[model samples]
Target: MPRNDDLLDNPRSPRVRAVAKLAKRDARSETGLFLLEGPQAVSEALTYRPELVLELFATPTAIERYDTIEQLADEAGIDVEFVTEAVLSTMADTVTPQGLVAVCRQFPTSVKEIFAAADGEGPKLIAILEEVRDPGNAGTIIRAADAAGADAVIMTGRSVDLYNPKVVRATTGSLFHVPVAVGIELPAIIARCREAGVQVLAADVKGDDLLAARQGGLLDAATAWLFGNEARGLTDENLARADAAVVVPIYGHAESMNLATAASVCLYESAFAHRA
Candidate 1:
């Protein structure tokens, strides 16, 4: 397919500079757009949320290698703007550019919509992050939630920005797969979950064993697993908000499990019970 516009070769052009600025939080907030790098992320946005993608840029070599990306872009009615390797590098946040970059609008699902019943279906499984500061952990949890058949994910106001480049990359395209509601407070989430007939279970160190909870049939319900900060875990006040606190028991010598790992286990347990 031939594009009418000239090849984007100038790395220092005003247009390239604007795209590169999306790497910063301020720029993303100001424009309601973020940068999507590599073929994986770009392919996902093109596949799952084509309307959100405003611009697609790829080097001729990249388009040749990832021919599927070009095809997907075409199917989504998005035109791929050809850029030089130098231009891609300038626009990409990574040290090694994957030759494909896209500018996408930040489409965050509202908390109300996440909990409300839609088309005779409401959320059955959800992952709630409270004051989680690490972008990788937050993103990985979203990815894991998607894998575990979670209905949605909620990141508290104190948590890392969901649109951060690191977080977006860590999601590995799951960001588009899952409905994520951001900037919500823990209390608001808990109240909404309860009103929606969902139980709130906190993943806390001082909580009861998860195996015991499963045996007690506690997992056999619509559940929202609340995960706290990586280092400090959940506060007493926040922990009290949940109907129960459940901990992932480590049988091995491993000191502790990462937040994302523990969350995945919890979410899968709920998913299994929901299906069973």
Candidate 2:
């Protein structure tokens, strides 16, 4: 239960400033915590990983509108602290916090745990992000990976910070749904995938046509799709490390597809083949 009497109304309070500081990478790195903005992200955190949520803040109206969040929070033994709209906004990274926000621990899965093939239960399909600095693209790829039933996502050391607020928001609620391993070097990840018997397939424009791979029965194997930066794609050295390189064919007169769109197509291709 929350105490309305103790409503946080100060937008300039020390606590509010501390929470707002989480928007910066240094603060998040030091505190091992990140900000969860909007009702959707907060609700997902409460539902999927309540233990990681250090604090929950919401406007009285927000709790009323999203009463299920309150119920879930209560069930998880989390006490919601009612805050004024101004206070909520001060603690949020987005322009509009949607009247709810949360402080959650950053839980990054180790690459070894992700590639753990003990008992022959390793991941069949995985997504690896290399030097993917665009927060939106990285997040969407993670969402697409989850939607395609991929086992996990691994972001190379050169990629954007996994705890970036923009990345978290772009994920919607899928950030909570997928296991993401961050900060691992690309070469090490590829080696681990090889040991796990997962073929690393680099998604690059210079690669073999995706249709050819599908026709060759390559998509049905335990595979890890490597996606690179939005602008540059994969470097030649990195591409050479892959078991194979694949390109999603562009059938239309359109110049090019967005990285996330191309990634979804590639991931779903494997998903379809796995089930077929």
Candidate 3:
């Protein structure tokens, strides 16, 4: 149980400042901590990964507003501290704090660890992003993968940091649901997927149509999908490395699909196919 004396009322408190600094990548790296804001992300963390949470801060109104979180924290025996709204604002990255915030340790997975813990016969579907710098897109892709029941998400070196504030917020708690492997090399991931008997499919314009793949039984296989940068898509070598490069057909006049949209389409198609 949390002590009443642990209330943090000073917005400028040194401890608050340190926790707020987690918004910066270097600070998160140096301190090995990150921030999860809003009720959804915070609730998911408390439910799925309570051990990773170091502390939770909320206004009195917020605690009452989200009574479930308070109950969860109490059940898990994690302390919940009262903080002034102003103090919470200083520690939060978004304009609307949702009145509840949590400081949690980052959980990163290795490619091998992902394969080891995969369900059923093996990992059936995976989403891989290379050099994807948009934190929001990265987060959305993670959400899509989680929704589609993909085994894991791998972000290559130079991709957006999973702990970025915008990324964490955009995930809407799916970040905690999905296994994310960050900062691995593209070739290494491809090799590992191959070793694990998964077919690597790079999403590209100059490849087999996604519809054709789905209809032809290609989507039913254990698949690892690679989506590249927003502007450039995947490199030629990356495409060449894949078992097959695949494309989603567009009926609309739009030039192409957005990063996250394409990812959801591809992942869900595979998921539905596997289940069928």
lDDT of each: 0.92, 0.91, 0.90
Residue range 32-121, candidate 2, lDDT tens digits: 999888888888888888999999998999998999999999999999889998998889888866888899998999887887775778
TM-score computed on alpha carbons, candidate 2: 0.97
Candidate 1 runs further than 4 Å off: 1-5
Task: Determine which window of 10 residues in candidate 2 has minimal summed lDDT.
Answer: 1-10
- Against the correct fold, how does model 3 do in TM-score? 0.95
Q: Per-residue error at 249 for model 3, in Å?
A: 1.0
**lDDT at 175, model 1:** 95
TM-score of each: 0.96, 0.97, 0.95
Over 4 Å off in model 2, which ranges? Answer: 1-5
Residue-wise lDDT of candidate 1 within 125-213, one digit each (tens)?
99999999998999899999999989999999999999998899999999999999999888888989988999999999899999999
lDDT of 3 by residue, 139-177 (tens): 999999999998899999879999999999989999889
- What clash pairs does model 1 have? none
